[model samples]
Target chain A: MRFTSESSADGIVTRDFTLDGIPGVLWSPAAGPSRAPLVLMGHGGGNHKHSPAMSGRAALLVRGGGFHVAVIDAPGHGDRPRTAHDEQEIAALYAARAAGRPEGPIVVRYNAHLAEQAVPEHRAVLDALQRLPEIGADGPVGYFGLNMGTAIGVPLVAADPRFTAAVFGLHWPDALAGHARRITVPVQFAMQWDDEHIPREAALALFDAFASKDKTLHANAGRHKELPRFEANDAVPFFVRHLGSAIPGASPALT
Target chain B: MRFTSESSADGIVTRDFTLDGIPGVLWSPAAGPSRAPLVLMGHGGGNHKHSPAMSGRAALLVRGGGFHVAVIDAPGHGDRPRTAHDEQEIAALYAARAAGRPEGPIVVRYNAHLAEQAVPEHRAVLDALQRLPEIGADGPVGYFGLNMGTAIGVPLVAADPRFTAAVFGLHWPDALAGHARRITVPVQFAMQWDDEHIPREAALALFDAFASKDKTLHANAGRHKELPRFEANDAVPFFVRHLGSAIPGASPALT
Candidate 1:
């Protein structure tokens, strides 16, 4: 489940690759051929390759922290096409949820439908990482997610134990409440102090319930978008300590 | 021609008016009507209300510094159409100047074109400011600019001399080389140490050439985009000192 990447101290090079016939983007710093650690970054809802948060983080990792970063679009996001449920159907689904019309089978079906659309794309990105020439067979890998990515990425880490560390920002407990026991890797949870969307207490409890050997909680003074500043400074060091040496291309010094 | 504007410590119910016509966006802590000292903000190139730099500066002014900030777009930029020459024609004009073609008539024509297209809109914004009921006749006013705004704002300050103080980031000396004598108000010139578009030495020379009775030069450690971090701590204090008390609706206490 773990993968290696290659990078250098100056700047990272982003190369396009196809995974399981699905196109994806890979990032690594410009360095002599050398194995380096990798961090898999997942974007938030309705985001794609050019999302500011993801691109900013990737730039920070390459220039500030000197880490190799990879990013991909999720299903029904980015350039992907809409599923059987277009905007109207999706609105109806949410309306149904809001109106307290409990259709258990329908909820399950919708969840499965989303997963069916997304999991393949996720696997494609992961599989492409394994096939990268520079990543090698034994390099360390980490996962970082924001919002919806937290929901999708946690299960990916659980299914594959090779992910040595993870960081989740602005995540609620219910997204992965039942799967906490499955995540054995070191994890860090970053939350906003006054987030309107996610209840702060519930988010803390979810991080606390995780059965990882090592877990840490962090908070920022600002709301959801501003949380990245704390991560820019804190998360890089945590990844370096847990995942391995700073990835040559992943260091912040380059930025 | 120095103008002053004052509001309560809460920064609501501003008192100074210089230009007339534009309505200020008002916010107060209390439910009732209030006013504060006005902070006039000018945006850079090709930006409008949705611009991140303008919005970020406005947010920082409101949240970090506790000030009432107003941002307006300039002419031929942001919600304004280009009624004049396209890029090729503009390039030809520059080429004509470089080739020492007839300069006086071309300069006059160019200025006339801009005056017709850009100046009226800017004057309209200023005119709007002159009519705010909360702003006093002699209340303090602070002006700040970035990039192209810096280019245009210098002439405005020179001609009007109403701004109590101002901050200019990323200025071009060639554009304002002749107007230094007109700038008698206290001013701060912030130049990036590593700005690629504008050389640091030239910026310093421009600041030195200014005729302000009181002025300070701040050297930030970042490029043009990162200048906000330098202002993160000092901007509020500088504005408060020059622009009088904070407004009631957008006070620092909210942060």
Candidate 2:
């Protein structure tokens, strides 16, 4: 576990770090004490730890809500080394999309492929976070992610008991629906009503499959890429309500 | 080759026989000549060769259009012997459906397991049909099926050149999507626009993935079961147009 860079602005501190080669960013209230509630954010496909949506959400969680936020680039994505297999797979995807071919199979296949590696890789990161002195040995954890995030989160969260809450995004041809029953944590799943890539029925079916007693579906009428903004408002409160009790060091700047 | 029962009524001749332990039904113009065009039909899941829908459509096709149709029991379905594996799989499926679990994975996994034998079983039936003198040595062949049919048909049709055209029903949960481009025969893919069991976008994507230049989508506003009746009208003409050039042996009685 190592911190490579740290910057502060508007009372929010952002730190760039890597744990055993997993590149990540952490955002926290600049004045918060050691050990704060942490939210791990998963980015969409073709995106990295510092994508606009990921960084912005990280900032919002820490700067406005006085919580801690963490994000890591999914394997084969930002800061992570690529391989010939990844390059060939991505080239085929671009060709399919450019030809106006069926997008579901292409995306579904890619998400499924990414998920095989992302889930275990994420667990490693979570294990690393547990060892960080700044995160507080017993800090409560939540997850925020969509698309590629859910592809990875669906399996990771189902297996990991550390997270108390999660906000899942997109519906990635629904590769992760099979794990829905195993995700016992309180969840807020969000999706666009007309996701161009995933069928609406599959999305609804995915939400219905979740066995979580406290799961809620937040659907908005928009395209896939525009969904995060609509979900950000509710996500904060859900996490804060579930994880806030442990964050006794709420930044005085926000208070 | 021996017909167990043959009945001629409603201008249709329906025959029941066992082909090497595979029970099947054949419908043809009551007075058609020995040689006629053939359209191999595939039935939905949990349905048999003589199921009301199967027999009804077979009757309608032959009676209404003077064509010959064939349907064989998919392995472990209809008259085929069910193994312990089949029973165990069915028990699990019932539990999943009863608990409202994600049907996609359960069904996809079951169908894939079945296809390991079902595809070859279907091809074996086609091989037997070739030995029957009544179907004619020169008769062109086509395929019609949906649901379990499409799951098996997608792969069989992609490899079998004996079929000149096909009408695939149900959105094959996409385990077979990888073979979409191999199906170069003219295809009339049918699906219910709001099928309770199928995602429409996946259906559209499947249609788009087909390499066949002559593929068409025959969509209707109904559920999975409601789709076949609407498609029968177009399916008959489509098959006849593609396979009829050689079936000039018109059964004078029907005309």
Candidate 3:
């Protein structure tokens, strides 16, 4: 793992890095204990590692939980180069959206393909991240993602034993239910009650598939893109509960 | 309303009061603004105003949100006298439990009957409580109740326009769907995913019936009696979000 550049603002430190050419970013409190829990975030399909959603949530984790948060560019996302298949899938997704057709099938298929490659990449990244001096090998880790992030996260979290907790939502179960069934860690899943793209039953089905004995479904009343901002603040407590904060009483109730 | 007794402990002031012939309890922050928002809570069947759930949540609202919370003994509940019909219903509910039968039907019927009587009683208590100097007539009010509370709260919140937000769940939709459809305030509903008495669909249908534009469903993986304690803490933020806190930045993220 190699950090290419580093910057600090608002008591949070942002460091850009790469491992095996997979670009990523890590956000941590500028002033806190040397070591803290780590949360791995997956950005949406069309978004990159530094997207506003990722940075905004990272700030919440950094300031609220005093946890280190990291996000890597998925294959063909962020600053990564896309293969011909990736280009074809992107075109198909755009076509579906432009034609006012349901984007579920295309997004599911495309994200599944990306997950096949991204999961191993994430595992490798985790291995390297754990080796960092500030994030020792035995600390707790969490996964937070939604939409396309959930598509990739369902499988990724299922295969990764290091992840102790996860927050996922906004995706269909067609391609993820089997993976969800294998996941036993605590989970907090979010979905839109009136989601435009995903059927309500499909969203509920995915939440039901999680084998975790401790799971929560937070369904808000809104369209797909209208997930309330407070949901981001809500995730802080979930992670803090499952993964103990390194600094006592440091977890801010960002709500 | 006339205060019968008063006491202070753990930063909360507890006051026992009565309106007409109905008994109730009020909990408030021991030190805060003279007048804060109020939350009216309904207790489950077979329980009273001072049930652990009621006092526990009252502590949260008072300390976490700087709000005054009141709970009245429902007709035939708490300190109130039970009529022969209440006795019959209680016997039926106990019989159902002993026979390993579903308690949904019996509890539903009994709670509905109680609600018919309790709704007007609660409304009168609210009117009386608002007359107090500490609880003015114009402050926002929220309703919180689960199980039997949901049964009663569904109709009560629907009929009252003074309530600006509510937290309800863990009840069947059969008798409450019509009333739920009339509530348009923000809501936070909770349900145990594995509740033995209420089917998941029934719990969900009741939540769906609410016409509130801003509503959230929190379904946790647990049995009927195993709702995680964090849910009580979760309610603090929901109330804080909808009903503005009286003391600036005094709302504690009790999570």
Candidate 4:
């Protein structure tokens, strides 16, 4: 998708817009009159559009590959109002649920319910992307999500089938597997061995379930926060293989 | 040296001052109503107050140890003006003095001159610190410099013996040794294995020249940019031992 060339001298432009009726911030690089492929990115839980992880990746893609990227605040993050009580109250609620609980069915049920409530907000963001003028209809479109974003994005891509390629970093297998069978586009999955939230087995299983014509999985060396920068070095090739023509200086390997 | 409790929250205040009569920015964190320990921090080449490497260390000291910290601009860097036309001009001028083959003699002469020009700026900052009412007469003072800061600070600290402790990260041994023997305060030296600027042997020789009754050396696992944060985690204890009480919950091994 081609972005308009009105970005600041630093090649970045910041704007506020409504996506599926949810207000959020968008950051895109200046691409002049030329059209560039668009990559829709989602941040991890409790992170906002200006999150270091998201902004860092945006910088790499903009400077390293000249791709137009956009990131939106997820529900209850950034400017979004918290639908629940204050942070302390929420922490206490979660603490109580974990107190004396075994690590099995009960915890799984509670998490599943939370995940269900979050899906619609994520879908809204994806749907809103379809309406943005900056995102051209004729070019390749990619989606990238990490952790919580991955949870929402995998299912959204599975249910919608419009994305040309998708990459999920440090995510769970069960949630991803359910949607993986439905993805027809190229998919890249990164599994972090030291992740605190997701198990390695589940990550591997999700990678195994992807029935996409082209799929790649990388077992990385750091914790979740360090994975994005690590994957950026690996992602250039993946993007070039599937969306090479749409991105400037796209290469088969990270230089 | 006890600073007033109120002053620590207000930050260190400075009087109007000039370096070579050139206006400069000066700042100090209010250590407290009672006298508290102080640290003089020097930024790396091409770096200033807001540089991530410098600011991150300041944050750690303030948040992790509650120490008062001060940082200053050096000659030809940040707010400081170049004595020569430009970097290339300066290099060329030095090159000509060394018979068009600028080698060790040329570099030593060039940096030594730069160090001379920077002394007054460093002193002006120290003068401002001494005038702070909150910093009382008894609180200990320390000095730490990173990269180029070490080049200038080693001479600055050695020539003036008021500091109670000093630390250098990424330093040139032969150049620094001129002042290293004069440092009576407890000293700490940290070096990165892969430092591109200061070779390992030079750093080691510099560390060995210190005649302080108490000395410590830390060989870290990363490059120059990563060394500060890693050393900051350990340097606090060194400061606590020679300066005052350890920061609460800080490990004793840090010293």
Q: What's each prediction's TM-score? A: 0.44, 0.49, 0.97, 0.44
What CAPRI-style quality would you assign to candidate 3?
medium
Return the TM-score for candidate 3, rounded to 2 decimals: 0.97
lDDT (CA) per prediction: 0.59, 0.74, 0.91, 0.62
Best by lDDT: 3
Q: Name the weakest run of 10 consecutive residues (lDDT summed) in model 3 chain B.
A: B246-255
Model-by-model DockQ, in order: 0.01, 0.01, 0.55, 0.01
Locate the minimum summed-lDDT window of 10 residues in model 1 chain A: A1-10
Clashing pairs in 2: none
| lDDT (tens digit, per residue) of candidate 2 on A1-255 | 689999999888888998888899888887766667788888988899988888778766775456788888887999998888788878888898899886677677777788788888777877887787767657788988888788888887888888888988677535787787788777878766557877767876787667776665555444666563535644665676678733465422111
lDDT of 4 at B116: 83
**Candidate 1 total steric clashes:** 54
Kindly list the per-residue Cα lDDT of model 3 for residues A75-141, writing each as its tens digit: 9988999999999999998999899999999999999999999999989999999999788899999
User: Tens digits of per-residue lDDT for model 4 on B72-155?
Assistant: 666677666676444865676556656645343444455666678777777766776677764555577788786677888789
Error of 2 at B200 (Å): 19
Compute the DockQ of candidate 4.
0.01
Better of 2 and 3 by lDDT: 3
Off by over 4 Å in 4: A1-9, A85-128, A222-228, A245-255, B1-255
